[model samples]
Target chain A: MDAITVAFAALYQFGDAFAFLVLSACGLAVIFGMMGVINLAHGEFIMCGAYVTVSGANAGLPLPLAILLGALVSAAVGALVERLVVRHLYERPLDTIVATWGLSLIATQGTLIVLGSTMGGIGTPLGSFQIGGYSYSVYRLVLFVMAIAVLAGLYALFNWTRFGVMARATIQVPHMAAALGVDTRSVYSLTFALGAGLAGLTGGLYAPTMTLVPTMGTTFIMEAFVTVVVGGADVFLGTAPAAVILAIVKSAMTSWQGQLFGQIGLLLAVIVVIRVLPKGISGFLLRERT
Target chain B: MSGKFVRGLRAVALTGTVLLGAGSAFAADPIKLGVLEDQSGDFAAATLGKVHAIQIAADEINKAGGIDGRPLELVIYDTQSDNTRYQEFMRRVLQRDKVDAVFAGFSSASREAYRPIVNQFDGLAFYNNQYEGGVCDANMIVTGAVPEQQFSTLIPYMMETYGKKVYTLAADYNFGQISAEWVRNIVKENGGEMVGEEFIPLGVSQFSQSIQNIQKAKPDFVVTLLVGTPQASYYEQAAAANVNLPMASSVNVGQGYEHKRFKPPSLKDMYVTTNYIEEVDTPASKAFVAKFKAAYPDEPYVNQEAENSYLAVYLYKQMVERAKSTKRDDLRAEIAKGDVCMDAPEGKVCLDPKSQHMSHTIYLAKVGADHSITFPKVWEDIKPYWLGEAGCDLTKSDPSEQYTPSNPPSKS
Candidate 1:
């Protein structure tokens, strides 16, 4: 392989790792990082999205529309969860972990019982393009762009939108926000739903590239948690940088050795980040600014 | 008064005797067979069909008046793809239920988990899944295709057709690890070079780096020993990336029916060696598939292991009949005679009493671009050659141990 091909391959690896980390972490970053709820059922919401997407596509809906329908359905489910279960445990963030963990188990087993263990998967869309001698998936590049778009869209929503202001206010101080005429409950519900919707979107997008199984969500959970933990409590500020750093570390090690070392490199990076920053990347950034 | 009382007592005694004779003629104790399989977990997709196949076998036997007038009753337990559950259920079936025989275990780990318990009871057991294939236990009968049957045919054919350079991608477990070694050995024996090999941990779905590595190596063919739902995605990713090298496997199309599950062209140009597939067009296989479908109208596919499980039930029946009893010692002695055989759906398969393993007729199945399967080659009467080479002669001595290539028998 030429140097150009090697460079393209390296770039491709970085993008793939970055997209995976960002997509997996984005939803959890919002739910656990921003909401302080430690929602362990985040992965199930992703599964719900993937399941709905595949079902929709199989039912003859177009792929993009199916993905949209998946996100909407996951959002609605998230809203319901927030109202029925998560609402009671908002004051006890630790309790939310246990409750959401229970919900995840219920969701996984429930999916298995209802839909069986396996489902036919959608074929990955778009063909490959040759780079020198090696071929690369066009859909993977699309995923990279989608990750950036999601982050940008989220940034706009939280910084520019009126609802974002209310959500942030509620998250910061629920009683104070309520006193200031913000319906904290609705903000919390909408924010949680948005988080879940993003997770669902991640699932929908990658559904084609993966085997559809009830336990598929577990595949994303570890990456999601590690990214969110390293990202800290600011979804926008922490997640992007953390994803970049971790993706670079992972892809480099993967290129050097293989996936096992890549994973080891990833977790080691996380440990170092946590040890150095203590409160995480965003927390350090916030302190530096103050 | 004495005469009347005596006459009444005689009449009552005669009625009781008649009723006892009627009951004895109608009901007999069922011959219990324990079935342990993953019905609803990770391995459920593949092993669920095996469970259904076992059910069909039991039903058919009972319909034909059962084994010597005793109904074959299945005491089934769902192991849920957990190793601990296999041990727990094995004990329940062996010690508590005292089942006459068992057909169980999906993975080598599960088999290893429960084999000791089976041995402790001196019970008869059948491990019916294709595995890394070096187990030598007196209490267990392995009906699945071993490496000698699978790789010997597949690797040589792959080398002759594809090229002399092979790359291996295997799941990082005992099965995949050992299977990779077999692939290496077979490739070398065929005068092919193992250009590259990677052991992927379970649940690592991302494969960009692995793909790049394979592309860089530019092997003539790739041998994938991937297992479970996560690793199966490699096909999709590889296809999307246009990794156009031919792929051969021992456990792909036959076990998970990847060609059926994945969309067209994902599994295109893939080859697999196995004793059975749902696509086997033989009359016996067709009838067996139809029977399984009839029993389980909603079953996805009748996998390779299901065939082993199906034939194992009949094989067990043969052992029982030959012994004229279901006692472990009697069954062992009968099986040791080396005459137990069954006209399995795959073809004629016989238990090799020396190794306690089945001799299988293997097929080389090729998956088409449109997800169709065609058998281009067949190898008949392939014995567990590796075990034999390792001197795993159960008739001579019961070592009750697994022999890997690196850990061959000392005597050998």
Candidate 2:
């Protein structure tokens, strides 16, 4: 067996996986936790966000501006979906899942008709930053920062604002909250939109780091699902931290074993976590829910 | 010969995100090549190898002042290894980016889906991965060896080198079935016997049935064409079962599916045919591998999908330079000339003038225990074994079996 390089390289890979995990998990949980919808189409929304960025750049828009346009477009799309499709599905989780899944399939197929069966890249429009030997793509670091900031902002939205308080009450006890004069329906719509907006933000953020594709979101979604599930779907806020831990663990696993064994081992870990901590580590975060 | 199909690809994409600014072709602007591949799906590992090929090609072209003094810009998107998404991503490149040309995908299903799309768009498509052949069209050049190219050489080689009996397993899709028919035909033609021919669905698990059958049949060589995550599970189960295959080969086995999923003994010593095996010698290939290794310091080279995309970018640059124009049709016409030489590790890229399908040299090799291949003949220019007359007339049977392998063994 080769001598495992348990050095700084391990830390770098761990950091990368950690960044990806935290962002995607937080993104998904924000949608699922606040919205209470499985939102299978969440991944497609991410891809759409990537396309929006690419399209804007193709139109000669500045990189930062193009990405902004992408996020705005993605948010608009999410908001529209919420207003149109998701709003109606309030109070129904399973229905939302099936409906969103259908939307995902249609959107993917629609993208196929639009993009053709090929992949493309957005030039590394941003600069880079080197930490030791690992020259991390500058955009990736920026995205990581943005993800953390967004998580904090979203935290503020929940803990520090009246909207957050109402949203929390609605999620915790809709019947009682409604009896107490909370407008649960609007809250559902607002939360779903916010979740989608986050997904769009992820797409926009990931665009520069990744090659744009319609199905790219699926890969992110799979990991995000594991993270959201393992993080505690109930705590809703536990999504990012849980996702980060799992991502780092997976990254470490891949660095130790090749990505092949790493993936299998991580998958096994996810299954085990799901089995043991069914609601995820977030269950620990939420004393009220537990 | 025809422009109808190519036009349809444009129609689908042109409807929405079409790049309307009709900027005249200028040397100042980079000659863009859209590289559509699956970066993060079941095929990600397999497709990852092509990225180096793409980057190296881009650098080489740019070093040479690109097409008519313009630098070549490579735009890549992940298909997530999904055919439907592959089509969508391709459309964005052509209609929106309006790239000079496009190189895309690692699977035959994706190629098939993109065929009509490419036809309608009338833009160049470098379909770089090996797959089952048959559907030929304009604006699309199938770079990887077709069924005829791969199966004809491997079947005869297997029968002559190994015993005459053969066992075949392939995914039950357009790519697999078409290639499977050709394999069966090649064996019959070669005077060898085929013991069994099995077709598994794309994601079907529970390979005990197929594994047991192959063992019971006791074929001299077991040829496989399965791909994706399911393949990993199949290999693991087969390894666990301890069913040592007589001798096996595949056009689709090097996709990194077997690397992390299966153990050492599994699929070892298996002979395989590919346009690329990492061991092929070349400075360009070396640079590509080096850069890729640098990029993903901890990860092993992914596979052909990335390499093909790399080749696609270079091929586009070569064609555009030869044509001295990036006005779509002119480059497509030059590619149609089919005589472009690629500075490739797998020798020269032999383009088919009529179909624009570049028939490059294929490598014949055997896999080692550590999931690496040792290519004996890294560059072998096997003639166009397009299975011309041997191809079952699709008009006869929708799911036809008109194939006749050269070495006809008694299938169990």
Candidate 3:
């Protein structure tokens, strides 16, 4: 590969990792960061979204609308799950973990039984363009943009919206927020739904770029969990910075070494970050900001 | 009155015992066939349909009055795609259930884990999945195409059709690694050049760097030995990037059925060689396909693995009939005597007596824009006899060693 092509490849690799981290981790960050609920079923939510996109696209809906519907359906399901199960397990972190893990298994196996283990996937729309004698997909660029947009949208929703304030207040001090006449219960449900909804959107977006299998979530869950863990409990400050660091480290290492070392590099970075700053990168940032 | 009732009950019990004895005398013991497959988990995508295919074949045999009036009883267990589970269950099926023959294992790892257990217990195992090959065991009957059988036929044709430059990508495991070596050997043998080669870790979904490298290498065609669910993403990623070079693969369509899984045009312009594809329009294949569809109307598609499983069950039946008994020693003796060939969906499938591997017709097919397969040529009865060339003689009854590439290509 020529120097320019190598440069372009590196850029593409960085973007790929960034988009992947954002897509897989952003939703879990919401649940784990704000609500302090470890959602082991986060991957399943993403899988559900992917399935919806595939079904919707096959049913003749336009690609964008299908993606939207997939996200919405995931959110609806998330809301329902939160109401029926998660609501009862609040403040019981260990119980929530077991509950969500069980939910993940049920969702995965249920999909397998109902939809079969594997299904045909939708073609990724938009084609490729050449740069420096290298062909790069426009759809990949779309993912990069979508990742940034999701982050920006979530930031605005949390920082500027009234729902965000109530959610923040309810989560930080539920008794006080409830005493002040805020419906803490509804806030928890909405926040959880939003987290799940983001995961669904990620799933729908990448559905076109992957084969649809019931166990697809397992592929994404490891990275999601790692990123969330290293990012800490602060959604914006910790998760975003951690994602960037990890993505850069991963992309560079992947290009330099093979994928195995790239993953190893990511894990090493996570360990180093956590050891240096026990609360994660964002937790350090929050302390400094405060 | 009590004495009379007791005498009547005694008479009835004696008559019932006599009738039960008569029934036992008339009905023969069923031949137990053990089937272990990954119905759920990572391997489910490839092995689930195979379970159904095994069922259909067993049902067909039972309906045909089984082997000489003795019914065939299929005892199946789900291995959940785990090698440990496979090891655990293979033993259970053999020792506890005492199945006459075992038809199981999918991945090369799973096969390797269970191959010895089958031999240690002096059991009959028929492994029927296309693998890296070169396993020669007396107790095990391998019914899949090996690297030489698949790639030797495929690479030469690909070189003739496209140019002599090749780029290869493989999964980082025994099957992928061995297949890549064979690819290298074949490319060298054909006077072709291998411009680039890479081994991808399984479950690495991102392929941007690999794609870039392929473009940089500018090979005439790319040959991927990539496997599993995550590896299937390469097609979509390649398509999205418009990597327009023609590609040939031994893995893609056969096991995972990626041709049917991915949307059209993604797998378009790719070539694959396998023993059976859904598009094998032979009368036998078509009939089998129709029967399968009739049995399970909602089945998505039947690929080579399912067909191979179906063929394995029938091949075992053929062995039993030839031996005239379900006894393991008799079956082994019959197999060792050679000439275990039967007509299958993919044409005549024969067991190489020397190597315990299969010899069968291979179809070189291409993916259409609509996800249908089009066979350009059917390379008939290609004996993987080269496995014997690798110095494995099953007739010697030595199951201690496996064959590996003697002259692996130099890493470029």
Candidate 4:
């Protein structure tokens, strides 16, 4: 009975870790899946959003309003960054990597300077709640809901909206879309902004769990890359399944000393998979790109 | 007439900008002390006390009519507690702003990131935290308790009290590994057999095998050289699993999680070894405690990190006054002399007069309810691992001074 209880407790603990993984995957899908841009600046976009929310909240703004402003600010910054910096680096993989890397640093430090302090955390109301004789995280449940909404909204936008249709068409055949009198450049810009806005929304929502810091993006960004690349960049929803699988596998690896090994193992496995199947694990699962 | 006026105005504007720039450069500024620490990142929660302590010290110093009548201006950078950010903070402090001295950071990772930079710039950095020791440099002053301070007190306390076979749990990095090594040596040397040892990753949540191994061994006590979320969750789960075994001494267990992990009431009687405690029954310590609680009522009690950082500021003040110069070489020489004492919790914490490291007092405390812990007595004037029983003389009136190498600090 004691062993059963302990196992249940461990499961609950792991469930909390899984919630963050899901959040990271939610951000990764759009940047990698829909628009097909390897956004190195995605993490910066998240960091900017988190910092903006913190600054906004610090300035005595309401929580919901701050979050909206944070996402908007992140999108504007993302749009400006894409226009001035990432736009030039398009089709140049090596150049984009260097450029986006610089942009991440600048965005992180710029936020730090503007905030003028190191510490930032939202006043969240997440307490452990027991349901049906089992412990569950209230905030984790909220995060799950938020991610679903974002995912659903994203699916609807890509399928039902004209702008999103143009985006998908351009993503599928940029030359053909251009020939059909579609402004592909503007589509790219808007798609990039949309991707950044989602990343920001994720960050703003995630800020309550972890405290805000300048380089907080470093961890989340790396996790985003891992999720997007391994989950399959072609399928918009692959990151969801990828995150679930990653979280469960990590849950099982608790006996392997620590979560760090689990993380390292995940990275290692991703590397091996990428080497063997350059198209990612999702490639084998999803026969078609769309 | 328009062209002539525009040219004249442009020249005046250019001259004004240059003058403003040059004027601010030489503005008889107060010596800037950079207080770099993890403010709002992973390590920030654990390191907040240390940063707060620096602020309190700076406030006190200013109230004391400033260092030699020139107020010390503290310019703090939040490394957001990231190792990479720490490097940037180091660059900004040493390369660009060029602070007179830096009193920043805790933990081995942050120290490792900042040490090379400190050496490269030959800038003085006062490291203020207890660490697994075994490093020395000219440009750095370690004011915190060393491995000798932490282990020597705690090891003796654990060995004498329990007399059980020892198994160790530590964080897996240079500091953690070194801490485990020290425990192994102390246990073996002091007539105890270690059944096993394990290293947990910095941010891990799993400790099943470790606990299973511990159950098999059933050692007298476990010493947690671990920190952050890993330590917290492991203890919580371990406790729930009835692995409610006590630690002989938890190095990273004080405010880090000593009171945090327990259920309705926090874990009682968790033995911890640290240099400073909030419950010290001293006039100076009491005042410091009151001041802190009043200033940041929502904040937690004083951890060793804060006390050390606070000491670093005062340490700089004393050194600067004694040396009478802001020159790096002169300040280093003054601190090397080690003739310093202030109203600190340790009651006159000072340097080694030679190695430039502080061999401050280390106390053993047990936590209680109401989020307060008490220290009965500390091993005062504790002999460091580097310092033997017979004592080593640092100052020698010999021909060594003949070199007069033009460097005030010899970096011995």
Best DockQ goes to which candidate? 3
Residues forming the 10-long window of minimal summed lDDT in candidate 1 chain A: A281-290
Candidate 4: the clashing residue pairs are B50-B305, B50-B306
For candidate 1, write residues A1-290 as lDDT tens digits: 68998899999999999999999999988888888777889889999999999999999999999998999999999999999999888777678889999999899879887887789999999999998888999999999999999999888888899998888778877888899999888898999999999999999988999999888888899999999889888788889999999999999998898888899999999999999988884552233100
- List clashing residue pairs in candidate 1: none
lDDT of 1 by residue, B1-412 (tens): 2557645644543332111111233277888888888876677788988888888887778777777777787877778788987887788788877888888998777898999999888888899999999998888898999898999899999899989999999998889999999999888877889999999988888898899999989999999999888889899999999998899999998898889889889998999999999889899999999998887888889989999999998988888888889887788787777778879999999888778898999999999999998899998888887887788888788888988888888884
- Model 4 chain A — which ten-residue stretch has the worst lDDT? A281-290
Off by over 4 Å in 1: A281-290, B1-26
Q: How does residue A275 of candidate 3 score in lDDT?
A: 93
TM-score of 1: 0.94
Task: Single out the weakest 10-residue window by summed lDDT for candidate 1 chain B.
Answer: B15-24
TM-score of each: 0.94, 0.55, 0.92, 0.65
Can you write out model 3's per-residue Cα lDDT over B1-412, one digit (the tens) per residue? 2557645644543332111111232277778878888888887888878888988887777777776677777777777778876777788778877988888888888888888899889898888889887776777788878888789889999999999999998998888888898899899999999999888887887788788878878999999888888888998999899898888988788788887778778888788889997778889989989999999898777888889889988888888888898887787777777788899998998888788788879999888877687888789989987757766776765654567787422223
How much is the lDDT of residue B343 in candidate 4?
A: 56
Residue A173 of model 2 has an lDDT of 81
Error of 1 at A181 (Å): 1.0
Q: Residue B335 in candidate 2 has what lDDT?
A: 54
Q: 2 or 3: which has the higher lDDT?
A: 3
